[model samples]
Target: MSTADDTQKTKDPEYLSTLERGLRVLNAFDADHPELPLSEVATITGLSPAVARRCLHTLLELGYVGKNGRRFILKPKVLEFGSAYLHSMNLEQVATPYLQKLRDQTGDSSSLAVLSGDEILYLVHVSTERKIRLGASVGTRFPVHATSLGRALMAYQPDSVIDAYLDTVELRKFTEHTITAKAELEKRLRKIRQQGHDSAQDELDYGIVSVAVPIFDTNRQVVASVNCSTSTTRVSREKLIEERLPLLQDAAIEIELALKKWPFLANSLRG
Candidate 1:
Protein backbone atom coordinates (compact mmCIF):
# COMPACT_ATOMS: atom_id res chain seq x y z
CA MET A 1 0.00 0.00 0.00
CA SER A 2 1.04 3.58 -0.58
CA THR A 3 1.81 6.08 2.16
CA ALA A 4 -1.52 7.81 1.60
CA ASP A 5 -3.28 4.48 1.92
CA ASP A 6 -1.32 3.68 5.07
CA THR A 7 -2.24 7.06 6.53
CA GLN A 8 -5.89 6.43 5.79
CA LYS A 9 -5.74 3.07 7.55
CA THR A 10 -4.14 4.60 10.65
CA LYS A 11 -6.56 7.46 11.07
CA ASP A 12 -6.85 8.62 14.67
CA PRO A 13 -10.20 9.24 16.30
CA GLU A 14 -9.06 12.64 17.58
CA TYR A 15 -8.02 13.72 14.11
CA LEU A 16 -10.29 16.47 12.85
CA SER A 17 -11.57 15.09 9.57
CA THR A 18 -13.17 18.39 8.58
CA LEU A 19 -9.96 20.40 8.90
CA GLU A 20 -8.02 17.60 7.25
CA ARG A 21 -10.37 17.62 4.31
CA GLY A 22 -10.02 21.40 4.02
CA LEU A 23 -6.24 21.18 3.95
CA ARG A 24 -6.42 18.38 1.42
CA VAL A 25 -8.57 20.55 -0.78
CA LEU A 26 -6.00 23.31 -0.55
CA ASN A 27 -3.14 20.93 -1.27
CA ALA A 28 -4.88 19.65 -4.38
CA PHE A 29 -3.84 22.90 -6.02
CA ASP A 30 -0.25 22.87 -7.23
CA ALA A 31 1.97 23.85 -10.17
CA ASP A 32 0.32 21.36 -12.46
CA HIS A 33 -3.25 21.73 -11.18
CA PRO A 34 -3.30 25.37 -10.16
CA GLU A 35 -6.92 25.98 -10.93
CA LEU A 36 -9.41 23.21 -10.35
CA PRO A 37 -13.15 22.87 -10.61
CA LEU A 38 -15.26 21.77 -7.65
CA SER A 39 -15.55 18.23 -8.97
CA GLU A 40 -11.81 17.98 -9.48
CA VAL A 41 -11.20 19.14 -5.93
CA ALA A 42 -13.57 16.52 -4.63
CA THR A 43 -11.86 13.86 -6.70
CA ILE A 44 -8.38 14.82 -5.56
CA THR A 45 -9.32 14.99 -1.88
CA GLY A 46 -11.49 11.89 -2.05
CA LEU A 47 -14.26 13.89 -0.49
CA SER A 48 -17.87 13.97 -1.57
CA PRO A 49 -19.14 16.94 -3.55
CA ALA A 50 -21.01 18.34 -0.56
CA VAL A 51 -17.98 18.10 1.75
CA ALA A 52 -15.65 19.59 -0.85
CA ARG A 53 -18.13 22.43 -1.42
CA ARG A 54 -18.23 23.17 2.29
CA CYS A 55 -14.44 23.22 2.50
CA LEU A 56 -14.11 25.45 -0.55
CA HIS A 57 -16.74 27.82 0.75
CA THR A 58 -15.04 27.96 4.13
CA LEU A 59 -11.66 28.63 2.53
CA LEU A 60 -13.14 31.28 0.26
CA GLU A 61 -14.84 33.02 3.16
CA LEU A 62 -11.57 32.96 5.12
CA GLY A 63 -9.71 34.49 2.11
CA TYR A 64 -7.53 31.41 1.68
CA VAL A 65 -9.03 30.56 -1.67
CA GLY A 66 -10.72 32.37 -4.53
CA LYS A 67 -13.21 31.45 -7.23
CA ASN A 68 -12.76 32.24 -10.91
CA GLY A 69 -16.13 31.62 -12.55
CA ARG A 70 -16.62 27.90 -11.94
CA ARG A 71 -13.07 26.99 -10.85
CA PHE A 72 -11.38 27.54 -7.51
CA ILE A 73 -7.81 28.76 -7.06
CA LEU A 74 -5.57 29.46 -4.12
CA LYS A 75 -5.23 33.09 -3.04
CA PRO A 76 -2.14 34.94 -1.87
CA LYS A 77 -3.47 34.68 1.67
CA VAL A 78 -2.52 31.01 1.68
CA LEU A 79 1.10 32.14 1.54
CA GLU A 80 0.68 33.40 5.08
CA PHE A 81 1.16 29.84 6.36
CA GLY A 82 4.45 29.37 4.48
CA SER A 83 5.64 32.90 5.36
CA ALA A 84 4.82 32.41 9.03
CA TYR A 85 6.79 29.16 9.10
CA LEU A 86 9.76 30.81 7.31
CA HIS A 87 9.71 33.79 9.69
CA SER A 88 9.39 31.56 12.75
CA MET A 89 12.43 29.56 11.63
CA ASN A 90 14.28 32.71 10.41
CA LEU A 91 15.36 30.55 7.48
CA GLU A 92 14.96 33.14 4.76
CA GLN A 93 16.53 35.88 6.85
CA VAL A 94 19.58 33.82 7.82
CA ALA A 95 20.10 32.02 4.52
CA THR A 96 19.15 34.68 1.97
CA PRO A 97 22.22 36.88 2.21
CA TYR A 98 24.57 33.92 2.07
CA LEU A 99 22.74 32.42 -0.89
CA GLN A 100 22.86 35.78 -2.63
CA LYS A 101 26.59 36.02 -1.98
CA LEU A 102 27.10 32.54 -3.43
CA ARG A 103 25.10 33.49 -6.49
CA ASP A 104 27.19 36.57 -6.92
CA GLN A 105 30.46 34.71 -6.48
CA THR A 106 29.57 31.90 -8.89
CA GLY A 107 27.27 33.79 -11.26
CA ASP A 108 24.85 30.88 -10.83
CA SER A 109 21.75 30.08 -8.86
CA SER A 110 22.04 29.26 -5.15
CA SER A 111 19.39 27.56 -3.05
CA LEU A 112 18.70 26.20 0.45
CA ALA A 113 16.49 23.17 0.88
CA VAL A 114 15.36 20.77 3.58
CA LEU A 115 14.45 17.14 3.13
CA SER A 116 10.66 16.73 3.07
CA GLY A 117 9.66 13.09 2.88
CA ASP A 118 11.32 11.68 -0.27
CA GLU A 119 11.85 15.09 -1.84
CA ILE A 120 13.76 18.28 -1.09
CA LEU A 121 11.74 21.44 -0.57
CA TYR A 122 13.47 24.63 -1.63
CA LEU A 123 13.22 27.18 1.17
CA VAL A 124 15.43 29.95 -0.17
CA HIS A 125 16.60 30.63 -3.72
CA VAL A 126 18.81 33.31 -5.29
CA SER A 127 19.01 33.15 -9.05
CA THR A 128 21.35 34.91 -11.46
CA GLU A 129 19.87 37.27 -13.99
CA ARG A 130 20.98 35.07 -16.84
CA LYS A 131 18.56 32.36 -17.92
CA ILE A 132 19.48 28.92 -16.55
CA ARG A 133 18.38 25.42 -17.49
CA LEU A 134 17.41 24.46 -13.94
CA GLY A 135 15.09 27.17 -12.65
CA ALA A 136 14.32 26.75 -8.97
CA SER A 137 12.05 29.10 -7.04
CA VAL A 138 11.14 29.14 -3.40
CA GLY A 139 8.69 26.28 -2.67
CA THR A 140 9.91 24.16 -5.55
CA ARG A 141 10.35 20.44 -4.81
CA PHE A 142 12.67 17.92 -6.49
CA PRO A 143 13.29 14.23 -6.12
CA VAL A 144 15.85 13.49 -3.38
CA HIS A 145 17.74 10.90 -5.42
CA ALA A 146 18.25 13.04 -8.53
CA THR A 147 19.53 16.36 -7.17
CA SER A 148 22.71 17.43 -5.43
CA LEU A 149 20.78 19.12 -2.62
CA GLY A 150 18.90 15.90 -1.96
CA ARG A 151 22.08 13.81 -1.93
CA ALA A 152 23.82 16.24 0.41
CA LEU A 153 21.01 16.07 2.94
CA MET A 154 20.52 12.32 2.62
CA ALA A 155 24.25 11.58 2.91
CA TYR A 156 24.33 12.54 6.59
CA GLN A 157 21.22 10.68 7.70
CA PRO A 158 21.46 7.57 9.88
CA ASP A 159 22.12 4.33 8.08
CA SER A 160 18.82 2.81 9.12
CA VAL A 161 16.91 5.87 8.03
CA ILE A 162 18.68 5.84 4.68
CA ASP A 163 18.07 2.14 4.29
CA ALA A 164 14.41 2.53 5.10
CA TYR A 165 14.09 5.34 2.59
CA LEU A 166 15.83 3.34 -0.10
CA ASP A 167 13.66 0.34 0.61
CA THR A 168 10.37 2.23 0.57
CA VAL A 169 10.80 4.95 -2.04
CA GLU A 170 10.68 4.31 -5.75
CA LEU A 171 13.49 5.90 -7.70
CA ARG A 172 11.97 7.50 -10.76
CA LYS A 173 14.30 8.23 -13.61
CA PHE A 174 13.97 11.74 -14.96
CA THR A 175 16.82 11.65 -17.46
CA GLU A 176 19.50 9.40 -18.88
CA HIS A 177 21.85 10.42 -16.07
CA THR A 178 19.32 9.93 -13.27
CA ILE A 179 20.18 7.22 -10.74
CA THR A 180 17.51 4.54 -10.75
CA ALA A 181 19.51 1.71 -9.21
CA LYS A 182 19.30 1.58 -5.42
CA ALA A 183 22.77 0.08 -4.98
CA GLU A 184 24.32 2.66 -7.31
CA LEU A 185 22.54 5.50 -5.51
CA GLU A 186 23.60 4.14 -2.13
CA LYS A 187 27.22 4.00 -3.28
CA ARG A 188 26.99 7.57 -4.60
CA LEU A 189 25.49 8.77 -1.31
CA ARG A 190 28.35 7.11 0.58
CA LYS A 191 30.83 8.97 -1.58
CA ILE A 192 28.97 12.22 -0.92
CA ARG A 193 29.18 11.58 2.81
CA GLN A 194 32.93 10.96 2.53
CA GLN A 195 33.58 14.01 0.37
CA GLY A 196 31.48 16.43 2.47
CA HIS A 197 29.71 17.58 -0.69
CA ASP A 198 27.79 16.27 -3.73
CA SER A 199 27.88 17.14 -7.40
CA ALA A 200 25.30 16.24 -10.08
CA GLN A 201 25.14 16.70 -13.81
CA ASP A 202 22.10 16.20 -16.05
CA GLU A 203 20.32 14.22 -13.38
CA LEU A 204 17.13 16.14 -12.82
CA ASP A 205 17.32 17.99 -16.10
CA TYR A 206 19.50 18.03 -19.17
CA GLY A 207 22.34 20.55 -19.42
CA ILE A 208 22.16 21.41 -15.69
CA VAL A 209 24.90 20.90 -13.12
CA SER A 210 24.76 21.44 -9.39
CA VAL A 211 26.92 21.07 -6.24
CA ALA A 212 25.66 20.99 -2.66
CA VAL A 213 26.91 20.79 0.92
CA PRO A 214 24.99 19.89 4.04
CA ILE A 215 24.36 22.57 6.67
CA PHE A 216 24.58 21.57 10.31
CA ASP A 217 22.85 23.08 13.32
CA THR A 218 24.29 23.89 16.78
CA ASN A 219 24.11 20.24 17.87
CA ARG A 220 26.20 19.34 14.82
CA GLN A 221 23.23 17.71 13.12
CA VAL A 222 22.52 18.08 9.44
CA VAL A 223 19.61 20.51 9.25
CA ALA A 224 19.52 21.50 5.63
CA SER A 225 21.46 21.56 2.36
CA VAL A 226 22.73 24.48 0.30
CA ASN A 227 23.45 24.22 -3.41
CA CYS A 228 24.83 26.14 -6.37
CA SER A 229 23.23 25.29 -9.75
CA THR A 230 24.21 26.32 -13.25
CA SER A 231 23.82 25.28 -16.85
CA THR A 232 26.24 22.54 -17.90
CA THR A 233 26.63 24.32 -21.23
CA ARG A 234 28.36 27.14 -19.36
CA VAL A 235 30.06 25.26 -16.50
CA SER A 236 31.61 21.80 -16.51
CA ARG A 237 31.02 19.39 -13.63
CA GLU A 238 34.75 19.54 -12.78
CA LYS A 239 34.61 23.33 -12.73
CA LEU A 240 31.51 23.25 -10.53
CA ILE A 241 33.32 20.97 -8.07
CA GLU A 242 36.58 22.97 -8.13
CA GLU A 243 35.01 26.43 -7.91
CA ARG A 244 31.31 26.52 -6.94
CA LEU A 245 31.46 23.65 -4.44
CA PRO A 246 33.87 25.57 -2.21
CA LEU A 247 31.60 28.65 -2.28
CA LEU A 248 28.58 26.50 -1.46
CA GLN A 249 30.41 24.83 1.41
CA ASP A 250 31.51 28.20 2.79
CA ALA A 251 27.92 29.47 2.74
CA ALA A 252 26.74 26.33 4.53
CA ILE A 253 29.32 26.92 7.27
CA GLU A 254 28.21 30.53 7.65
CA ILE A 255 24.57 29.46 7.91
CA GLU A 256 25.50 26.84 10.49
CA LEU A 257 27.25 29.50 12.59
CA ALA A 258 24.20 31.75 12.39
CA LEU A 259 21.99 28.88 13.53
CA LYS A 260 24.28 28.29 16.51
CA LYS A 261 24.14 31.94 17.65
CA TRP A 262 20.36 32.06 17.28
CA PRO A 263 19.46 29.37 19.76
CA PHE A 264 15.81 30.31 19.76
CA LEU A 265 15.72 29.95 16.00
CA ALA A 266 17.35 26.55 16.34
CA ASN A 267 14.75 25.48 18.89
CA SER A 268 11.96 26.68 16.68
CA LEU A 269 13.43 24.71 13.81
CA ARG A 270 13.54 21.61 15.95
CA GLY A 271 9.95 22.14 16.90
Candidate 2:
Protein backbone atom coordinates (compact mmCIF):
# COMPACT_ATOMS: atom_id res chain seq x y z
CA MET A 1 0.00 0.00 0.00
CA SER A 2 1.30 3.44 -0.93
CA THR A 3 0.87 6.38 1.43
CA ALA A 4 -0.72 9.68 0.48
CA ASP A 5 2.68 11.35 0.94
CA ASP A 6 4.26 8.91 -1.50
CA THR A 7 1.45 9.46 -4.02
CA GLN A 8 1.67 13.19 -3.54
CA LYS A 9 5.45 13.17 -4.12
CA THR A 10 4.88 11.64 -7.55
CA LYS A 11 2.60 14.62 -8.39
CA ASP A 12 0.17 12.37 -10.30
CA PRO A 13 -2.28 10.02 -8.65
CA GLU A 14 -2.04 7.64 -11.61
CA TYR A 15 1.77 7.65 -11.61
CA LEU A 16 3.11 4.38 -10.30
CA SER A 17 6.32 5.15 -8.44
CA THR A 18 7.32 1.52 -8.18
CA LEU A 19 7.01 1.01 -11.94
CA GLU A 20 8.91 4.21 -12.68
CA ARG A 21 11.69 3.25 -10.26
CA GLY A 22 11.88 -0.23 -11.75
CA LEU A 23 12.21 1.17 -15.27
CA ARG A 24 14.81 3.65 -14.09
CA VAL A 25 16.79 0.81 -12.53
CA LEU A 26 16.68 -1.02 -15.83
CA ASN A 27 17.78 2.07 -17.77
CA ALA A 28 20.76 2.42 -15.42
CA PHE A 29 22.32 -0.49 -17.31
CA ASP A 30 23.74 0.22 -20.73
CA ALA A 31 26.51 -0.87 -23.12
CA ASP A 32 29.16 0.68 -20.90
CA HIS A 33 27.72 -0.58 -17.63
CA PRO A 34 26.07 -3.82 -18.59
CA GLU A 35 26.49 -5.38 -15.17
CA LEU A 36 26.38 -3.74 -11.80
CA PRO A 37 26.05 -4.61 -8.15
CA LEU A 38 22.88 -3.74 -6.26
CA SER A 39 24.61 -0.76 -4.64
CA GLU A 40 25.74 0.54 -7.99
CA VAL A 41 22.23 0.22 -9.42
CA ALA A 42 20.83 2.17 -6.49
CA THR A 43 23.45 4.88 -6.92
CA ILE A 44 23.02 5.10 -10.70
CA THR A 45 19.25 5.27 -10.55
CA GLY A 46 19.15 7.68 -7.57
CA LEU A 47 17.02 5.27 -5.61
CA SER A 48 17.59 3.99 -2.12
CA PRO A 49 19.32 0.62 -1.84
CA ALA A 50 16.19 -1.02 -0.47
CA VAL A 51 14.04 0.39 -3.28
CA ALA A 52 16.55 -0.63 -5.90
CA ARG A 53 16.82 -4.12 -4.45
CA ARG A 54 13.06 -4.55 -4.58
CA CYS A 55 12.94 -3.34 -8.17
CA LEU A 56 15.77 -5.68 -9.16
CA HIS A 57 14.02 -8.60 -7.51
CA THR A 58 10.80 -7.79 -9.37
CA LEU A 59 12.68 -7.51 -12.67
CA LEU A 60 14.46 -10.78 -11.95
CA GLU A 61 11.17 -12.53 -11.31
CA LEU A 62 9.86 -11.06 -14.55
CA GLY A 63 12.89 -12.51 -16.41
CA TYR A 64 14.02 -9.06 -17.51
CA VAL A 65 17.21 -9.26 -15.46
CA GLY A 66 19.53 -11.91 -14.10
CA LYS A 67 21.79 -12.06 -11.09
CA ASN A 68 25.35 -13.36 -11.19
CA GLY A 69 26.36 -13.82 -7.56
CA ARG A 70 26.48 -10.23 -6.35
CA ARG A 71 26.18 -8.57 -9.74
CA PHE A 72 22.99 -8.02 -11.76
CA ILE A 73 22.78 -7.94 -15.53
CA LEU A 74 20.10 -7.45 -18.13
CA LYS A 75 18.77 -10.71 -19.50
CA PRO A 76 17.96 -11.49 -23.12
CA LYS A 77 14.31 -10.92 -22.30
CA VAL A 78 15.10 -7.24 -21.90
CA LEU A 79 15.47 -7.04 -25.67
CA GLU A 80 11.71 -7.55 -25.96
CA PHE A 81 11.19 -3.87 -25.10
CA GLY A 82 13.34 -2.66 -27.97
CA SER A 83 12.07 -5.37 -30.29
CA ALA A 84 8.49 -4.46 -29.51
CA TYR A 85 9.08 -0.85 -30.47
CA LEU A 86 10.92 -1.91 -33.61
CA HIS A 87 8.09 -4.21 -34.58
CA SER A 88 5.48 -1.59 -33.84
CA MET A 89 7.30 1.14 -35.78
CA ASN A 90 8.20 -1.32 -38.59
CA LEU A 91 11.08 0.98 -39.48
CA GLU A 92 13.64 -1.78 -39.48
CA GLN A 93 11.45 -3.99 -41.65
CA VAL A 94 10.70 -1.25 -44.14
CA ALA A 95 14.28 0.09 -44.22
CA THR A 96 16.07 -3.26 -44.43
CA PRO A 97 15.65 -3.95 -48.17
CA TYR A 98 16.55 -0.38 -49.08
CA LEU A 99 19.56 -0.40 -46.78
CA GLN A 100 20.64 -3.70 -48.34
CA LYS A 101 20.28 -2.20 -51.81
CA LEU A 102 22.35 0.78 -50.73
CA ARG A 103 25.03 -1.52 -49.38
CA ASP A 104 25.03 -3.50 -52.62
CA GLN A 105 25.36 -0.35 -54.67
CA THR A 106 28.02 1.34 -52.55
CA GLY A 107 29.89 -1.77 -51.40
CA ASP A 108 30.02 -0.15 -47.98
CA SER A 109 28.11 -0.25 -44.73
CA SER A 110 24.63 1.26 -44.94
CA SER A 111 22.47 2.07 -41.93
CA LEU A 112 19.10 3.51 -40.93
CA ALA A 113 18.94 5.49 -37.72
CA VAL A 114 16.57 7.74 -35.81
CA LEU A 115 17.20 10.50 -33.35
CA SER A 116 16.94 9.18 -29.82
CA GLY A 117 17.51 11.69 -27.04
CA ASP A 118 20.67 13.60 -28.01
CA GLU A 119 22.10 10.66 -29.95
CA ILE A 120 21.52 8.82 -33.20
CA LEU A 121 20.15 5.33 -32.58
CA TYR A 122 20.99 2.77 -35.28
CA LEU A 123 17.93 0.74 -36.15
CA VAL A 124 19.21 -1.27 -39.13
CA HIS A 125 22.66 -1.89 -40.54
CA VAL A 126 23.69 -3.65 -43.76
CA SER A 127 27.34 -4.48 -43.92
CA THR A 128 29.42 -5.09 -47.02
CA GLU A 129 31.46 -8.24 -47.50
CA ARG A 130 34.63 -6.22 -47.16
CA LYS A 131 35.72 -5.62 -43.57
CA ILE A 132 35.23 -2.01 -42.50
CA ARG A 133 35.60 -0.76 -38.93
CA LEU A 134 32.94 1.90 -38.51
CA GLY A 135 31.94 0.68 -35.01
CA ALA A 136 28.26 0.96 -35.81
CA SER A 137 25.65 -1.78 -35.26
CA VAL A 138 21.96 -2.02 -34.50
CA GLY A 139 21.28 -0.41 -31.07
CA THR A 140 24.47 1.62 -31.19
CA ARG A 141 24.16 5.30 -30.24
CA PHE A 142 26.43 8.21 -31.14
CA PRO A 143 26.23 11.87 -30.32
CA VAL A 144 24.14 13.82 -32.84
CA HIS A 145 26.84 16.53 -33.02
CA ALA A 146 29.41 14.17 -34.56
CA THR A 147 27.72 12.06 -37.25
CA SER A 148 26.29 12.68 -40.69
CA LEU A 149 23.18 10.76 -39.69
CA GLY A 150 22.68 13.15 -36.79
CA ARG A 151 23.18 16.20 -38.97
CA ALA A 152 20.74 14.97 -41.60
CA LEU A 153 18.09 14.27 -38.96
CA MET A 154 18.67 17.51 -37.12
CA ALA A 155 18.61 19.59 -40.30
CA TYR A 156 14.90 18.95 -40.73
CA GLN A 157 13.89 19.60 -37.12
CA PRO A 158 12.01 22.77 -36.17
CA ASP A 159 14.22 25.77 -35.52
CA SER A 160 13.20 25.95 -31.84
CA VAL A 161 14.11 22.33 -31.16
CA ILE A 162 17.40 22.71 -33.00
CA ASP A 163 18.22 25.90 -31.15
CA ALA A 164 17.35 24.36 -27.79
CA TYR A 165 19.54 21.33 -28.56
CA LEU A 166 22.52 23.43 -29.60
CA ASP A 167 22.13 25.76 -26.64
CA THR A 168 22.14 23.03 -24.00
CA VAL A 169 24.18 20.17 -25.44
CA GLU A 170 27.80 20.03 -24.41
CA LEU A 171 29.52 19.46 -27.73
CA ARG A 172 32.35 17.07 -26.99
CA LYS A 173 35.15 16.86 -29.54
CA PHE A 174 35.57 13.25 -30.61
CA THR A 175 38.25 14.11 -33.16
CA GLU A 176 40.00 17.11 -34.64
CA HIS A 177 37.27 17.37 -37.23
CA THR A 178 34.40 17.18 -34.75
CA ILE A 179 32.50 20.44 -34.41
CA THR A 180 32.53 21.65 -30.82
CA ALA A 181 31.05 25.09 -31.36
CA LYS A 182 27.27 25.48 -31.28
CA ALA A 183 27.25 28.28 -33.88
CA GLU A 184 29.40 26.29 -36.27
CA LEU A 185 27.23 23.23 -35.82
CA GLU A 186 24.10 25.32 -36.42
CA LYS A 187 25.64 26.65 -39.62
CA ARG A 188 26.52 23.14 -40.74
CA LEU A 189 23.00 21.91 -39.99
CA ARG A 190 21.59 24.78 -42.06
CA LYS A 191 23.84 23.84 -44.94
CA ILE A 192 22.70 20.22 -44.69
CA ARG A 193 19.07 21.36 -44.85
CA GLN A 194 19.82 23.46 -47.91
CA GLN A 195 21.73 20.66 -49.70
CA GLY A 196 19.37 17.84 -48.66
CA HIS A 197 22.33 15.75 -47.36
CA ASP A 198 25.14 15.78 -44.84
CA SER A 199 28.67 14.38 -44.70
CA ALA A 200 31.05 13.48 -41.90
CA GLN A 201 34.76 12.92 -42.50
CA ASP A 202 36.83 11.50 -39.67
CA GLU A 203 34.65 13.30 -37.17
CA LEU A 204 33.37 10.27 -35.28
CA ASP A 205 36.32 7.96 -35.96
CA TYR A 206 39.64 8.21 -37.65
CA GLY A 207 39.67 6.96 -41.28
CA ILE A 208 35.90 6.76 -41.44
CA VAL A 209 33.61 8.83 -43.63
CA SER A 210 29.82 8.80 -43.96
CA VAL A 211 27.11 10.54 -45.96
CA ALA A 212 23.44 10.60 -44.98
CA VAL A 213 20.09 11.86 -46.23
CA PRO A 214 16.82 12.40 -44.39
CA ILE A 215 13.79 10.14 -44.87
CA PHE A 216 10.51 12.02 -44.94
CA ASP A 217 6.97 10.89 -44.16
CA THR A 218 3.80 11.44 -46.28
CA ASN A 219 3.50 14.94 -44.89
CA ARG A 220 7.13 15.66 -45.84
CA GLN A 221 8.17 15.51 -42.20
CA VAL A 222 11.63 14.12 -41.50
CA VAL A 223 11.29 10.65 -40.02
CA ALA A 224 14.70 9.04 -40.07
CA SER A 225 18.07 9.10 -41.80
CA VAL A 226 19.92 6.64 -44.05
CA ASN A 227 23.70 6.64 -44.24
CA CYS A 228 26.57 4.94 -46.03
CA SER A 229 29.80 4.56 -44.08
CA THR A 230 33.17 3.72 -45.62
CA SER A 231 36.81 3.68 -44.68
CA THR A 232 38.55 6.86 -45.71
CA THR A 233 41.65 4.87 -46.52
CA ARG A 234 39.69 3.02 -49.19
CA VAL A 235 37.62 5.97 -50.47
CA SER A 236 38.30 9.66 -50.87
CA ARG A 237 35.90 12.29 -49.53
CA GLU A 238 35.30 13.66 -53.02
CA LYS A 239 34.56 10.16 -54.35
CA LEU A 240 32.16 9.40 -51.49
CA ILE A 241 30.38 12.71 -52.01
CA GLU A 242 30.12 12.16 -55.75
CA GLU A 243 29.10 8.50 -55.62
CA ARG A 244 27.78 7.26 -52.26
CA LEU A 245 25.81 10.40 -51.35
CA PRO A 246 23.49 9.91 -54.30
CA LEU A 247 22.98 6.28 -53.39
CA LEU A 248 22.18 7.17 -49.77
CA GLN A 249 19.73 9.83 -50.93
CA ASP A 250 18.03 7.33 -53.21
CA ALA A 251 17.68 4.88 -50.35
CA ALA A 252 16.17 7.59 -48.15
CA ILE A 253 13.67 8.49 -50.87
CA GLU A 254 12.78 4.85 -51.32
CA ILE A 255 12.25 4.45 -47.57
CA GLU A 256 10.04 7.54 -47.54
CA LEU A 257 7.95 6.15 -50.37
CA ALA A 258 7.65 2.85 -48.55
CA LEU A 259 6.62 4.65 -45.36
CA LYS A 260 3.94 6.60 -47.24
CA LYS A 261 2.36 3.33 -48.34
CA TRP A 262 2.06 2.18 -44.72
CA PRO A 263 -0.25 4.37 -42.65
CA PHE A 264 1.22 3.01 -39.42
CA LEU A 265 4.71 4.01 -40.51
CA ALA A 266 3.56 7.45 -41.59
CA ASN A 267 1.99 7.99 -38.16
CA SER A 268 5.13 6.79 -36.39
CA LEU A 269 7.28 9.48 -37.98
CA ARG A 270 8.74 11.84 -35.37
CA GLY A 271 7.75 15.42 -36.02
| Highest lDDT scorer | 1
lDDT of 1: 0.88
Tell me the lDDT of candidate 2. 0.87
lDDT of 2 by residue, 1-271 (tens): 5667766878987888788899999999998899999999999988999999999999999999999999999999988988897788776668899899888887889988888879988888888766655577889999999999999999899899898798779899988999999899999999998899998898987889888899888777787888888898889888998988777777777888788667786666573
| Per-residue lDDT over 1-271 for candidate 1, one digit per residue giving the tens place of the 0 to 100 score | 2487548745876677678789989999998999999999999888899999999999999999999999999999999998888878787668899999888888999888888889999988998887866688889999999999999999898899799899998999999999999999999999988899999999998988889999887777777889988888888999889987777878988888888777777665433
The residue pairs found clashing in candidate 1 are none
Q: Give the lDDT of residue 194 in candidate 2.
A: 88
Measure candidate 1: CA RMSD: 2.4
- lDDT scores for all predictions? 0.88, 0.87
